[model samples]
Target chain A: MSGFTVYSATGCVRCKIVKGYMDAQGMTYVEKDMKAEGKEDFQKFYAANRRQIFRGPEGVEFPIVTDGTAIRQGVGACLAYLYAGRELDGFFSAGTLHKEWVDGIHAAGGNPAAGEKFLAVVRLLKGNNFKLVVDTYGRNPALLEKLLAENLVDVAVMEVMASAGLAGAIFGQPLAQEDIERSVALVATAPEYRFQTTVVPVAEGGQARYLTPQEVVAAAKLLATVTRSKKNPYLIKLYRPVQPKDERLGELAPLPAAALLAYRSQARAYQVLAEAEKE
Target chain B: MAYPSVYPTGVTIYDPKKCWSGYTIFQAKEAGALLIDMNGTEVQLWKGLHGFPNTILPGGYVMGHLGLRNNAFGMQDQTDLVQVDWDGNVVWKFNQYEYIEDPGEEPQWMARQHHDFQREGNPVGYYVPGMDPRVDGGNTLILCHKNLYNKKISDKRLLDDTIIEVTWGGDIVWEWTCSDHFDEFGFSEAAKNILCRDPNMRTAGGGMGDWMHVNCMSVLGPNRWYDAGDERFHPDNIIIDGRETNILAIIDKKTGKIVWQVGPEYDTSPALKKLGWIIGVHHTHMISRGLPGEGNILLFDNGGWAGYGVPNPGSPTGSKNALRDYSRVLEFDPVTLQIVWQYTPKEAGFVHPPDSNRFYSPFISGAQRLPNGNTLITEGSGGRAFEVTPDHEIVWEYISPYWGKQMKMNMVYRAYRVPYEWVPQAERAPETPIERIDVAKFRVPGAAPLGRKKETAIEGTKPYQGSTALCIAAAEEVDEK
Candidate 1:
């Protein structure tokens, strides 16, 4: 069939947004509320593709759009495919970190082809009037500068992966501090920007330790110095390792809310983002 | 038939030869103590009789509580611990433990009994071949709650766990409070700081700090360790585990001091390192003497959230400082802290990595070693109970069909398997082995057939002629131009 099916639940805000966008665009599709009239159909569909469904902490994600062969989950991916004709896999979206692009860069080994392909996709998406949001780890300074110079990104987010002592655990290979500084400086030039760091457990010498309050402060100082603005929005997100890639990091215990607040308090140089701003 | 039959609930699998066939008793979430035989046939059910856990005594006697205190006054507080015979007559009762007046409620005595209790004859409260629980007379050791404040534990009022042994005539014979031995728990300075401030405070009991939230407690009973000069594993020693604190400790009945323990910390030794962090654990007990793995410490190491320590990314508050996804049934040498036998997903025969969570229950579960060298596991959070042999082959399985109206989930607090002869009032059901249903084939009536590779047609569009794939390709082609 030419149309796709959108599986949704009641009171799901993102599901409503996607349906609204589709309606305004005059798109023809079927809507299935998993809890109500379409429960049986969803169940049959779910049973057939049980292994493919992504089960996260909140259980199954909603607004699942299936076009027979390819299944797009969550509002981000559904909108990306429906609006911009971009199929995303593994939580890929315009707003989140560009992990797929980073993986392409890693696979290309200093080749410019990966960068050109990404820029092309960005242009294609921009042509569709999609509000572009990008998150980067700042591994490639020149590429980040190019994106900023082109004025292609609406909102830019730079994620500070780790503080000094914990960098080796987070970054697989050594990333130059100068490159990170350049990327941070470039990211600030965007219309809307945020410096975010997710406090996660880092394994070193068979032991795991969380980024201490002092460590978080060091990252905040770096961001402040690079951007030359204490007003820069910095978000401290507590990571919940539901299914972590690193097995050793899984052994570490979860930090309590008090410690996170303590970390937020210690980073006086950084301007904290409100809770609603968190993903 | 009450639920969607994605998979059948009662008796999905049964292997009578491998399983130690018995009458499985558990408190259905709706209301009642239900006894099911080997075939998952409902043999008997005592309506209106509920329990944090319903236990079956010898000679057809069922033990449970009649009612629960309002959540506003107490967390999981039972009003009266009572026993009833085959005809549902209250044979014995106890409630004179604490007297309190909840807001807008009458002042009355509350048993305050919560997670667990054990009678004198049976050490673990479940059945063992030679040691049947006394139906006529036996003192009851109850794991109850006591609302009190101790500055050493926290500044707020503490909902501390208190073990009390009460006679058949409802007289308190002995008592031990958890907060009294707080210092002996060996909390680090950081953990202590967090504890003093929070103590895992809950809104129940008008903002009481449930510091130790001890979920399970039972007497050690006759053990090989005790017989071989390990005074710490004495027959009368009480074993209890704190759900909030990640501690499984034994209390000396005479002195009421913590003598043997395994967490709040697990890395103190090499053996404990292998055992890992036992967080949010339950049903910690020494295996009864007649059981195969007797003298070993058995517990359902429910690896969910618990403990106090330096905050990591996962636990932001540090109050519930530890976190893990999978559950493990661990049988270990308590003295050496070495894991003797374990039932993780690996043991449960899952092939893929990270499959450990497939056999997990984050909260409210238990393990019992049976006479036939098999273990009956109550994966309570999912309302599933199954029997596993020494090889970890699931010989029998049953999922509880009774879903709670208030909680909106089918969660069994605990389950116990007693010998068929114990409940002679009901005839034993014919033991028919039910094979595990093939999930791929099971489907609701009139639903689409599964595993067929036919293209699914989207509504409001013609099938095959203008398909979704072609539509996506057409859109992509337009973008490319």
Candidate 2:
């Protein structure tokens, strides 16, 4: 385990966020897309670390990471380790850290050598304990396809931005729906992957340009149509607007807790795992 | 989740000493609503629930909808509205699931309510404090969605918006659906035919077919117009707006008929078009008898795509048109339809219209006529709510910092200003009083916070090493999206 390998998801934003966090800490690791060979490529890695990765009675769920010895699975489990420092003690029991790691960095007075946040993050992600990133597949995911063809990756995950009516406006960019659908199809067939979206409203200029609750359900239905995974977890995350003020998505409102719940109820029609993530 | 001294969070651009003295209440799209003073201290967390059209009582009780259940095992996000005491106790709870019944229909039950709800007897729920000429008893007015059908209207099943008044005893005293009075909405023959074919509206239950999304509705309350003998402006009249069709109308609550409306066709009409197309407006409220411009309509003009564009003789009836890029706030006399005052990006100090996107939220913005003659506007999408004087000077402003229960971000739905007298224990803490800063000169100190950490990866490179090289193409492109 010279450099712990990450079976990266096809297109998962959390995977990206996690990787970014790790980069700030200066932790080293190798990244691979799990969908490289469809199920075949994922199967090899799955065989290597089968037990530590799988959970529940049936052995499902993925984005498994191993230092060739111990392993970590699921975003929550990995975050607990990444933020909790070394020892993996209380890793499963303690859960995610709510303290802002950047606060420690800020307190360091710009001295990267004395940065406690970086040191803590690196210590937590140390050794064979690699990470898998996730996000919505990028436009024209030819790289994702090529990676899937290679079968030399970890896992895959994606997110549905909005339903058909809002496909073009919400992201402040051309969504490239054909590629999204293709990536969705590829991930759905891949051995291990997840799909999600931030249930937040997009505002352009000071007004709300976010999809209505109706559009959220519509997007879920669209995802349901593409993925055969009946229980495909559509992780509806609480939205956090992009920082430093990008001109495109000015400001956005996150969906309300209750309205989000009602939305999950509405999405139940699609028979997918409509889950809400507390930001 | 970390950003440096974010706007709408921690009083970024505040003139605490200059703002009207009182607490502002608003629910972040993700975080539950909070009541804070000029100093930006949380008077009440009112956690566990999301604020939508929430109001504070004379006591310390906060009334709002149950936002998200963080501890629940099943569908945690249920539509259960609650009233909490000062200690955050559940004083009253209305589960939309158990209630919301419609008589004489097969399923009979309406879906969960969204956007707005009003408590009739209180008048406290009204945007302004005013006296009502008539008493309808204490009932809650709810804007709800339901799949409905009627032979009198189109036979095709439709997702209709219904306004129902429910009593504390759990009885629906009155019910009104917009679809029933379809003929009165003033749609052209072509518009009507096209709407029947594709009534563009969006919602979770309606899939992609929700037509006439009634975003906000409230009993007109007492207004000068009624005092001046305009029966149409009676306190009991219910004023509502259709986001999809862009129809701002006053329905005679007694007759349940739309007596006056401004849209469904602004482009075709001279009077309406000059006032500008009221495309996708929200939070329509009569200024109340006591406010400065009482009887005038205060509307947040959300400029965006709405309605089925009527076809010209040569063009098809179902023509689609691009929405105007700019949004405006209009305060107009309802009877004369004359705009008394207005605010736009240009007025907000923007150089050009398109640059005013900061002022334009195609949906989810609101306006309030404060007692001090200043208008408190919630640029809802931006999550920035501020108060501006009659002269258009911004005095107080806040951006919501709490991310919602489910999402990492939060945007405000609407915000209201209340006098210090309104909150019983309003002075739970001392006000720190913030001084407005030169934002251009301000910067967050130290290494960039987590949110400020920019992506620094080289194109197609891994953290460690591998001989696979990389995709190599599209490598120069940024990953900002």
TM-score of each: 0.59, 0.53
In candidate 2, what are the lDDT values of residues A108-195, reduced to their tens digit?
Answer: 1122232344334323433224332223333435544544554422356665754423545554446566767787777665557777
Predicted candidate 1 versus true structure: per-residue lDDT over B368-476, tens digit per residue:
9999889999998889999999999999998999988889878888899998888888887788878777777777799777766777867798545422244234332
Interface RMSD computed for candidate 2 is what?
10.8
- Top TM-score prediction, candidate number: 1
By lDDT, the best candidate is: 1
Report the C-alpha lDDT of model 2 over B1-481, residue by residue, as the tens digit. 1234444365554554555657888885655668888666778777656665676765656677764332221112235556677787777665433222123322212225667777755442533555421122356777766566654434555667777666564444466778878888877776667676666633333233466878888778777778888888878999999887888999997788888788877766566766778878898878776778877898998887676665654335563343666688999877767789898876787544335565777778798887667888888876778888888888877877766565555577788777776677755456565566766665577634344346685888758743224443221221222
The local distance difference test score of model 2 is 0.61
Which regions of candidate 1 are displaced past 4 Å?
A1-279, B1-5, B351-353, B448-481
DockQ of each: 0.01, 0.01
Lowest summed lDDT over 10 consecutive residues: which window, candidate 2 chain A? A100-109
What are the chain A TM-scores for all the models, listed individually? 0.64, 0.48
